[model samples]
Target: MKEKIEQALFEVRPYIEYYEELKKRVEEIASTTDEEGLFIKLLEEEIKKSEEPFKTDLRIFLQKFTSFL
Candidate 1:
């Protein structure tokens, strides 16, 4: 399970970087839009979507560690 998680991280690392860049770009693009509320909402949605998987992985890791203890 640990190895599987690591392998998954290796596969997802690039996407994480991609999403970071995308999040930055979204913020920059949103800054230029007149509908600031909509822009902020979309930006947050993009970030939340990208972050959920990572958060899940962290929660799984914490559970694994707690079980080991």
Candidate 2:
């Protein structure tokens, strides 16, 4: 699972700082918890709050995480 997260990080390397911190938090959260739905809900809320490029990036990141599940 760690490896998958690392791979997902690589897959989205070009994204901005917002996602960088979010990704790190995700890694931490994932390692410590099994609450997948919570992450999805969080991401959905973020996606709703975000503007264009970040919104698209978040969607893509969310899609990648969902694929991991």
Q: How many residue pairs clash in each candidate?
A: 0, 0
lDDT of each: 0.45, 0.70
Which residue pairs show backbone clashes in model 2? none
TM agreement with the true structure for every prediction: 0.31, 0.63
Q: Write the per-residue lDDT of candidate 2 for residues 1-69, one digit (tens) a residue.
A: 566666776777776446776676556556654577875776687789878876877777778877888
- Worst 10-residue lDDT window for candidate 2 reads 25-34
Q: Mind giving the per-residue lDDT tens digits that candidate 1 earns over 1-69?
A: 334333433444444534454434544645566564554455455545646565444334333323432
> Candidate 2: deviation at residue 11, Å?
2.1
Candidate no. 1 TM-score: 0.31
Report the alpha-carbon TM-score of model 2 versus the true structure: 0.63
